[model samples]
Target: MTGPARGGADPGVAAAFRETMAAVCAPVAVMTGLEGGLPHGTTVSAFASLSMNPPMVLVALDRTSELLALVRRTRRFGLNLLGAGQAGLARRFAAKGGAAKFAGVAWEPHAGVPRIPGSAGFVGCTVAGLAHGGDHLIVLGNVVAAETTGDAPLVYHRRTFGTPAALPEVSG
Candidate 1:
């Protein structure tokens, strides 16, 4: 095999795991919540649909994430799926800015959460459950509301921001 084996404390294991995950093309999004009635958000790639019958989703946040505290307090959050043109926004939210991130950003209150304009999709949710997973906490949510504009989605792959491309057509 390439890197270390799947076992004990080899430092390269962490690096190898990160490198492997970096090869995955994941959607870029901002997970937002309210603190003191003000908005706080952070960019994340670890989001996914968990259920369809009841409309549920899961997002993994770092254990030290400030927004995680907000979700714990408010029991609500918004998943804002970014458009391909929003790489700048994704970087902005990825930075360390509590309420300051929304300073110049134009967003509106929608279904009890901050909804940024021009996103590919938005999902307003109530925190349903929490689980400890290594260095991250998986937050399960029941989607209370959702919307989509059909915009091209932003994605991250190979340690860089990007969008997916369609495969070439194959003629019979």
Candidate 2:
């Protein structure tokens, strides 16, 4: 990678940054919103809880992503945390098919946003603020509703989808 990648960042630095981040496991999720009563979503791994007092979360979406634009206007969105067994579903949303991606998938509106069934967790949020990041926009949301299914979460590591496991304890 000698030149810039698709987002126009230095390829060398971008590749290195990606590889470095890949070493750390991150949760896999689909950020979902509605466009005129039609569901739209995309896979995202850059989301995290920002605060507990006010119950806030933040997700980073590509600046040019249609889902980002939709959420901006709707002022609401859902984060469906994928379970360990939902790698195929993750890829489905990650692919570039637009509205066509939800053709055969199952989801419904919950707490004013679309929620995918059988996910590890779900959180419906209202957009609180937005900030510009390099190549991505940080959306700060006030969590309105949340639930968990207690399923093991899917994770991304080393450019692959996987499940997290506990390490064996060691004593000397």
Candidate 3:
């Protein structure tokens, strides 16, 4: 999808830079939510912790996404950290135009937010703040409650899904 063009960087150069950047980064999560009672989600690598004092986290959603609109209206959402085996669920939810994304996907409602079953972890949050950045909307959430199933997290890199090969050695 084309976002608003900035500066005069050659399109080819920009594309190459993006690819390189993606290669250097590791995927973290996919978030799921309901829009008008229909399941909606997207593969997002931009999820992160924003604060610990108030228990806040952030997920960046494309401004053009229908999910973003729903999030703005509903004010509640769920973050589902994908497990290594949940790649199919990620692709299914990321598909365009479908009401059956939730089909066969085990889930339960927590405070009106849909939480994915078998996810590595699930966080129920309310939209506490929003800010526009580039082509994305940074969604700041106030964590109301959370749970973990202690599963291996799915990783994405270089435009492909993967699992952690090994953990970094602890330093003394």
TM-score of each: 0.93, 0.92, 0.85
How far in Å is the alpha carbon of 53 misplaced in model 3? 0.8
Identify the candidate with maximal lDDT: 2
User: How should the candidates be ordered by lDDT, best one leading?
Assistant: 2, 1, 3
Q: What lDDT is reached at residue 121 by model 3?
A: 86
Candidate numbers sorted by TM-score from highest down: 1, 2, 3
Q: Once superposed on the true structure, which residue ranges of model 2 sit more than 4 Å away at CA? A: 1-11
lDDT of 2 by residue, 6-61 (tens): 76888788878878998998999999998778999999999999999899999999
Q: Candidate 1 on 1-172: residue-level lDDT in tens? A: 3554455546677888789999999999999887667988999999999999899999999999999988998999999999999999999999997999999998888767888999999999999999998779999999999999988899999978988889999999
Model 1 superposed RMSD (Cα): 2.9
Model 3 lDDT on a 0 to 1 scale: 0.80
Please write out the lDDT profile of model 3 over residues 109-144, one tens digit for every residue.
Answer: 775777777789888899999998877999999999
Select the stronger candidate by TM-score from 2 and 3.
Answer: 2
Global lDDT of each model?
0.91, 0.93, 0.80
